[model samples]
Target: MNKIVYTLLIFLIFNHNFYATNYYVSNNGNDNNVGTIDSPFKTIQKAADIMSSGDICYIREGIYREEVIVSTNNLTFKNYQDEKVIISGADLITNWLPSDIGSNIFEASFTGAETQFSMLFVNNKRQKMARWPNNETDEMMMPEDVKTGYEDCQVFNTRSGKNGRRVKFPNLSGFPVDHFKGGIFRGIVGKKWINPMGIIESSNDTELTVTAISDDWGTNSSKMFTDNGKGFGFIFHLNALDQPGEWFEENGKIYFMPPVGKDPNDMVISAKNRKLAFVLNNRTNIKVDGINIHAASIAMKNTNNCEITNGSVQYLWPFFTRKGYAVSKTEQGGIFIDGNENLFKNMYIAHSWGHGIFIDGGRKNKIENCFIDNIGWIAQFTSSIQNFGDGTIVTKSTLGSSGRFHIRTNNKIDITYNDLYDCMKMGQDAGSIQSTNGGNWGVPLDLKGAEIAYNRIHDCNTLTDGNKEFVLALYLEGCFNYTVHHNLIYNFKTDVVPDGTFVYLGPRMATIKDCYYYNNTVWNVDWGLRVWNRENRGDVENILFWNNIIDGKANDGETSDNDRNVNSLLAKLSFKTNIRNITGNGNALFVDANQGDFRLQTNSVAIDGGTEVSGITDGFNGNAPDVGAIEYGSSFPDVGSNIDPEDISFELISDSSTLSTNSSDLKKESIVVYPNPSNSLIKITNLSNNYIEKISWKLTNLNGRELFTGKALTIDISSLPVGVYFLTVNKTKTFKVIKN
Candidate 1:
């Protein structure tokens, strides 16, 4: 079917509404029973078949153990009561016998199809598929040891010596060599960012070969090298199941080593078979709340005004093809939604091998106060949140210690007040919050009016071997008409180099024009801001970077146009080529940063040093506007929300925790500066005697320019010009010292 015609047909069908009704389902009821609170239907599918428009299906507390297929419009599916409504795809396994191949190993035959599963769970935890180097290490085998080719689909050479289909490194060697003839090989071939799984077709002591499991990697990884690149190899076979908790599968037979002396019959082993939980097509005005969706994915397409709140979708590995090939599961994840005005709030999404929540195309959709973590452990997955729609808001949420939160080819998006960290664990060249132009898809898209503000983004792109892939806290490539303000971007560390920075603007083949970077605080970062201009596309022009507090370097490329910037804290603002009306001033400031606080002190020079930005700096406390994210006299601006990301309660909780209390917390009397707006000299007092004994002080202006450095509490500023200034008493404390 044609895509455009199909989309139009779905839109027309979803435009109408009908009468509403409520139905119920339970585990104890039979399929033939009428769906009611007292007499509920047994199967979820049976209730879904008869559901009409605006109908509500309440699933009672119990494990339904079936894949729900939704074919109705404006229908709601939720838990009938406060008890758990677990919709699971995996079935419990119990039959077991001792393995004849090994002493402690056990075998179990499954009644389900042989191709039903490649992953297994014991006690609700994913079991290891038997890999070597038992512990993950920073060092992988060098690239020179291995060579890849697609023709053999099965032929390759490894310098590491352990060959054929099984890996027998010097530190690790066992009976796994005999099982390599027909088993599968899953290895991290190069850079550890991509894993290729293949079936063994032929093997020897030093030579091995297999067909590629994933389509993303054809014959070999394009980035793989015979010398400089590196990766690890994993072997999963019954012979390699020497450790407890390890498992292997062949045909309909499964092998396990029941953790020490524990019997396999006494353990609960589950294997996921079905794929989807709720497959909604052209559905609208529905809500699925307080239900537990496990081991399955949900698909909602062409839907409007739908919500999935206070619920969870976890452990979803839709395609566990153990036949040794890469599974391209891009369109599948915990939740796949494409429509308008959808809300996914207060949800707990975790432990998925693929994306957590994928929003393809929608408008005014929100993913708020949700906890998204432990997603995309394998590099093949897309990760946390990938939204390719306009007017999407991901706010007041905590996202990712794994996978990247990315936005691509859309506009009018607001990503604010979220705590994002420990990202890009499996992939590279990205950040915790990243966006790019839609032009890469050969389509015209607008990025105008897009805002990325008040976000606490950190610890991005931390994975590396030897290559230099620049990562950022906020990465905007080929985007324009964007406003990035009041963000706290810091602590971007790399193992190889401090090459990545807080912000990376303008890609080599793209343009960044008319974008404003204002009032942001950046510290402990290599590059405060990096902007580039290339001759192939449009130049970086008309960028207004003002009132930012950066304690790092700034690099603007030669070919870029004028940057209308002022009140920045770097030593010098660099623009190699001179463009007309370029203004860079008041840029030397010293922020006495203690911990993560970048607030201006009472008498800091930056308090009122910045020139007024017409609409940007409207809410000021003093005569002139203050630089950086927080204004001195007014209430401190809050960077991230205080809502616990792991909070999954289904009640109405106030978001008042998002407010900041920095001023009250820092008003300690242990370190105090006296003399109100005085001239030249000032007196300092310390309630704590130990604080006065060994104290060092420094004074600086708001532009981050250091004016004084001494240990004495009494300092003479009378000789200097009268202005606003900040005085630091100790390394950990900052006090406002004014000079009249």
Candidate 2:
């Protein structure tokens, strides 16, 4: 009975451990077991190894020197303390050999400013040490410890102030050496300065190759070198340096250096490709919230059905050299969504080397309330490579197949209420959000059934100097069934150039209606809106431009004919050009000489002045519809309500006959309320138009709870909230009620 009781207790404990497992990883303990809270693992990799789907690996605060790769499908790797969890490289060289005759052999430098001391040496060969005579006198006396006495000495170069000199040597093994080069013989002229220069470059695995080197005999040596001998060099040994470091390797993965520091912008000394800081690859129903991802390259890609909300992504720009030319271009981003059906909301993505949030070849996505600034590219999607030329090259086309295609047709895309500012360049083969001449490169082929409304797009032009005309406010082409309305676009100007233009609309049919363009101002631009239909197939029809206020005063002073081209297109189409109600100083319209046939109708109110169509009933305003977006007033009823206070009655009049009741003799009076269903504040002006003493008012909700009770000819209703209410007024001799 005792043994059975013990067995049952052990079984229950094991079951409890299996069901409630919360792994923890810190900078202590062996990284081999299931990382529990008490018996925790040392590294994040160990925690990941034992984590299954729906498992959480909570990491403690410390700088970890390992590239954590997540192979599990649905596991999370997060930090507990919200501190910096740095996974960096090892910093020590393991296998090293010391040589006495250090002529061709490069040794580590002791100078603190030298950044080349941490390099690793490969293809080390054994060679015999040679020694010279110690002195001219005392020839019979032999030097003790020959390897340390005279064999290790070499011609050392010392710099005093701005000058440097080379003098021959000391003989010591494993001693500190300054600026030593690698080769065959020490103190020899040809091989003295044969140290190999360390090379660091980035390339794919397909470009890796091995080559053989030649010795002094002109024969092919057995020693092989990598591409350009990049990884083959001698660096300062660890013990000779000021900072003590260690080389850590676990599970066949070697880490070569520690993290530079806790700061994400600190430079890292490594050669291996780092694992992504954040990855969203082929995932479905995944959501990441409120993460601050900074200083990462090639961060995220190939994700699907993921939502990233309330996050910040910033890249650190580092100086680099390419073909001996100094260049600085950081490659980092926030969330890179490549799959389909993702949502990003309320995110602040800035200071990225690439786009803030790059969406490539995805369908049915929604990006709302995002603040994107100081990024390379704002938002882009394309279908044609030719249209995306002269921008960032995201993907290149190959033989027998076109390049990357968006192919996302009718995908229910919504870009609303976003603040896009100061996003400069697009990625490789990808144009800026306004580039691509309206996303005509990738698949989906068209922006069919998309909505770009209620956004604030300003000051995004003039990022590139060469193509000032490339700047655009809102560009659309090859898209159908799209709507751009209710947006605030202003202060979009091009850089100073002769050919700079703004707002390019290509050969596509679209509806641009109800967009309140207040101060849609431009500077140094050739035209405000350049609508060019090259196809000439009349496919660009039913393109409406309604209620747009364009202010292009800067370009009005130009003597060139470019301004005439835009007005000519408007005239040729007999398109609606409503210029009325404008309160600015500039040329209203400029038509070309050859396009005289296109004319505004006489007395057509749209010529120099437009009829007031704001409150008109008919959709089309006059006998001839106004040329522009806004039409002249017509006999049709306007859009707003026509409140007739006299028509509203609360009287119990006769149903069988339109019998009369005297205005003043009636015991009960009919009350009328104007502007019923009011927004925040309601006005209850009496239609009786007569002064009566002591008019009492009461307002009640459906539950009959009195919301307001007051007595006045006109009451202050600024404090009332939004809802339905009943208003009752009592006169001295009559009682009347109304609904609001």
lDDT scores in order = 0.60, 0.34
lDDT of 2 by residue, 1-740 (tens): 69999999898766643553567776654577556655567776777566665576765533454545455555555655342333332221232223232222222222111111111211110111111222222111111224221222222223322112232233223433322222112111122112111121111211211111112101211111111111111122222222212221223332232223211111122221232344446545444444433333222345555666554433311111111111111222224455555665554443322234444455555554444443321112212111111111211111011111111122335444443333222211111233222334222124444555444444434322222224444544334455554343444444554333334444432322222222122323334555543333213434545434344342322122333333433443222343433234322332211221112234533433433334321344345334332223321111111222233221211111110122232223323343233333333433233433445777766566877777654444435554556666762222223222
lDDT, residue 437, candidate 1? 61
Q: Candidate 1 — worst ten consecutive residues by lDDT sum?
A: 650-659
What TM-score, computed on C-alpha atoms, does each candidate reach?
0.71, 0.43
Query: lDDT, candidate 1, residue 664?
Result: 43
The alpha-carbon lDDT assigned to residue 640 of candidate 1 equals 37
Report the error of model 1 at residue 285, Å.
Answer: 1.0
- The candidate maximizing TM-score is 1
